[model samples]
Target: MKKIETFCPVRDILSQFGDKWSVLVLILLEDRQVLRFSELAKAIPDVSQKMLTVTLRSLESYHLVARKVYPEVPPRVEYSLTELGQSLLRPMHSLIDWALDHKDECLK
Candidate 1:
């Protein structure tokens, strides 16, 4: 097969979810259903709070994640996937499963 030299716009969308943090956050949100900021922080200790905040904001901008805040003194914030985001789960899980199955070979 010959490689075509062309710019693909799909790269823009993929770029958003291609990062490790984005993938992790999406996976976590999908599995947990809904999670608070602190809960997410606890779940992903490797990621800095700032980075997670950025990731959540990015997802929100893309309409893939929905964030809700409750009116309270301390403020209660929760994150979950939007309907559009939910639609992406099947393919995302498939990709995840593929990676897991190929982990040993890829790790080498």
Candidate 2:
């Protein structure tokens, strides 16, 4: 395949998890360890159900989130970060720290 045919890793990764909702979802999971769909929805009150679903699907597709389903009368589903996802938290924290430190300057 030509070089152009190869996907840009940086762009692809950002496209997958660049949005506010995606970052919020990942951060929530990082803090909570495990949460049900409803719990996640409740925690992020501004996020619509559809947006949450989409974000969760994207994270799961990236292997950053794991979904577990329990076969029960009503069924139970939970989400948590994988090892790879946990590893990403370190860099995310660094980015967050940078943003905080530059917030005033960037806003001006």
Candidate 3:
């Protein structure tokens, strides 16, 4: 297959997942498959409610995450990865592995 050249820099891609909260949300959803807003907040206590809301919205806008709202008495919302989002796990995990492997060098 031929590779298409583009003017876009890798930083554009990195900017999306490079944020502190986005990757954490992604990894959490990846492990749990799906989670409610409360569950995510509980799992990541350091993330403010506003930040989590913003992160989920951004991820949803990018088509990397799906949000489902259920009609109930108080209402319910859940978050999960889309097919496109699932594709990201491989590279994300690879980066995690690389960081773990190079932790000593990186810390120096």
Every model's TM-score = 0.88, 0.90, 0.88
Considering TM-score, where higher is better, how would the candidates rank from best to worst?
2, 1, 3
lDDT string, candidate 2, 63-94, tens digits:
99999999997999999999988988899889
Q: Candidate 3: where is the Cα deviation over 4 Å?
A: 1-9
TM-score of 2: 0.90
lDDT of 3 at 50: 97
Candidate achieving higher TM-score, 1 or 2: 2
Tens digits of lDDT, candidate 1, 1-108? 534434355678888877898888889998999999999999999999999999999899999999999999899999999998898889988998999999999999
lDDT score at residue 88, model 1, on the 0-100 scale: 84
Error of 2 at 89 (Å): 0.3
Please list all clashing residue pairs in model 1, or write none if there are none. none
Supply every candidate's count of residue pairs whose N, Cα or C atoms clash at under 3 angstroms.
0, 0, 0
